[model samples]
Structure formats: structure tokens, C-alpha cells
Target: MEHTQKLIHKIINLTPLSTAYEHTPKGKRQLECYVKNTCGITAKHLARIYRVRQARQLIKANPQLSLAQLALECGFSDQSHLNNEFNAILQIPPAKYKKLIQQ
Candidate 1:
């Protein structure tokens, strides 16, 4: 249990959950099960939320960064993916969020 919590913390700090699972001592399936049971959210969902959270921080810190660049830095596949996920989580597009912050 202590080890699992450590693993989860490590994963949360790392970008791109796919690669994080690959590096885990246990198989991906076992890690997924442990995370789901312990956290009450699937690892994939947690990863997406963490990515969006990181992107939001970056957006605030550097409001001038382009969406594509933010997407790449946030481990998103593309701007559209970042937009979609960001919208889903925050109910606002990244571009609009940046503009609001800048104003």
C-alpha cells in the first residue's frame, strides 16, 4: 500500500501516463487495478486531469504561448485534443482562458 501510493505520486508528477505505466515494476494491468481501487478513478482519467491541470498552470505562467506549443508541452497529441480536454475539465477553451488571464 505504501509502495502503491509512492507509485501513484510518481505517476502524477510525470507527464504522459502511458509511459509512466510502462516503467512501473508491476505490469500495467496490475498498476491500473491498484490505482483504480485506491484512487476511485481510472489511471487514464487521472492522467488526463493531471495533464489539463498542468496545461492550465503553464497557460497562466506564459499567457503568450500558442495552443500548439502548450499542447505539446502538456503531453497532448495536438491543440484540438488539448482544447477538447481542457474544455471538458474547466468548461472553457485554453485560448479563452489565456485571454482572460491576460486581461
Candidate 2:
């Protein structure tokens, strides 16, 4: 279990989740199983979560940044994309989150 958590952290921290995976010699099926067992989510989903976390960090660093700029910086397609992610993951939109953080 310790090794499993270490592997997950390596994938999550060392690189963006999009390119973090390397399928083993066994095959794609094994890779899929490994991903599911390691983190219970797909790589694409992990990448989205990572992007939102990155956005949040950037927001904290520069509270004056615009949502459009934050989205672009964090690799979201647009402001709405960032907004959707913030709402889905955080249950609050980026604008409101920013406002609360500033207080």
C-alpha cells in the first residue's frame, strides 16, 4: 500500500498527468487496471484535477489575475472551461472563490 501511494504521488507530482503514464510491457489492459487500482480514476480525469489545482495555486499567488488569464495559464481551453472545472470540483465558481480568498 505504501508503494502504491508513492507511485500515485510520483505520477501526480513529478509531471502533468497527461504524459505521466507509461504502459508496461504487459499491455494497455494492464495499464488501465494499474491506473484504476492506483488512483481509482483515469489519467484524463487526473489531468483535469491537476489543472484545477494549478489554477488555484496561481490564483493564490496572484489574486488580481483575471479568470481568462488564469484559464490560459493553467491550460484550460477558456474562462468557461476553468469556471466549469471550479464549479464541478469545488462546488463554487472561480469568481466567487477568488473573492472569498481575497478576504
Candidate 3:
């Protein structure tokens, strides 16, 4: 339990949208350590959530990727899961966000 708390703390302190997916195993340790200490969340969970954030940035950068593809690439189970988390974390659905960006 205490270990989980520590992991959660580390995750909360993590930097945004790092480009470390291509890092070697050892290089990924910092991310593991951070996620371990902060959320006790599985590495897969962290990866999925982090990738979604990355996808959002990619959308912002290009605005060309379809939402379905974005959700899949981001490791979300589907567009609806992406929608739920996107809305929960950002207070807006992806569709709404895309519309807002184009406005």
C-alpha cells in the first residue's frame, strides 16, 4: 500500500509527452520508476494514457489523423474509452476538442 502511494506520487510529477518510447530498456527505467512510485499503475496503463496525450499533441501538430486511428495508436481500447478518459481528464470530448481547435 505504501509502495503504491509512492508510485502515485512519482507519476503525478512526470513530465508531459516525452519522446522516450524509442528509448532502450534502461532508458525507460526512469519512466517505470516514475510510474511505479506515483500510480502503482501498471506500465501498460501508463503507456496507454501517456500515448493518448502524445496522440493529442500529434493532432494539435497536424490535425490530420482520424479520431479512431488516434485512439487505436494511443493504445486505447476504442474511441469510447478515449472519449471517456479524454473528457475525464480534459473536461471535453475529443470531438468537441477537435471542433474547438478548428474554430
Candidate 4:
């Protein structure tokens, strides 16, 4: 339990969208198993959520940033990818969210 918590903490603190289990001392399969058993979600899924959360924070902090720039900073492949994730998670596009925040 303590080990799982430590791993989860480490994962949460990692940069957005960094889902590589290779950085962990444990094997990829072990890390996956720990995450799944502890959090009931795959590490990849958690990473995606974390990325979206990070992007939201960044967007709120800098509403003037372009979607493409946000995508790059948030570890998304491109603007479309960021848009998809943002829409999926927030149920609104990034531009709309930014407008809402700015107002």
C-alpha cells in the first residue's frame, strides 16, 4: 500500500503526458499492475487525465496563449489533440474555456 502510494505520488508529480514507465525502478508490467490494482485505472489513463488537468491550469494562468502553444507546453502532439482531450474532459473547447475564463 505504501509502495503504491509512493508510485502514485511520483506519477502525479511528473510532467504532463509523460506516461513512460521506463523511468520507474519497477518493470513496466509491475508498474501497470500496481497502478491498476491501486487506482483502478491504467497508468496511461491517469497520465491523460493529468495532462488535461495540467493544461487547464496552464490555460487558466495564461489565457492569451495559442492553442498550438498550449498543446506543445502541455505535451500534446498538436492543437487538434489538445482540443480533443480538452473537449472530452471539460465538455468544451479550449477556446471556449479561455473565453469563459477571460470574461
Q: What is the TM-score of each candidate against the true structure?
A: 0.87, 0.74, 0.54, 0.82
What's the lDDT for all of these models? 0.85, 0.73, 0.62, 0.79
What is the lDDT for 18 in model 1? 62
Candidate 1: where are CA atoms >4 Å away? none
Model 1's lDDT to the true fold?
0.85
Show where candidate 3 strays beyond 4 Å: 1-49
RMSD of 1: 1.6
Least accurate 10 contiguous residues by lDDT in model 4: 14-23
RMSD of 3: 7.7
What are the clashing pairs of model 4? none
* Angstrom error at residue 97, model 2: 0.3
Q: Could you tell me the TM-score of candidate 2?
A: 0.74
**How well is each residue in 34-96 modelled by candidate 3, as lDDT tens digits?**
556666766556655665576678678767678888787665678888888888767788888
Q: Model 2 off-target regions past 4 Å? A: 1-29
Q: Worst ten-residue run, lDDT, model 3?
A: 15-24
TM-score of candidate 1 on Cα atoms, chains taken together? 0.87
Question: Candidate 1, 21: how far from true, in Å?
Answer: 1.8
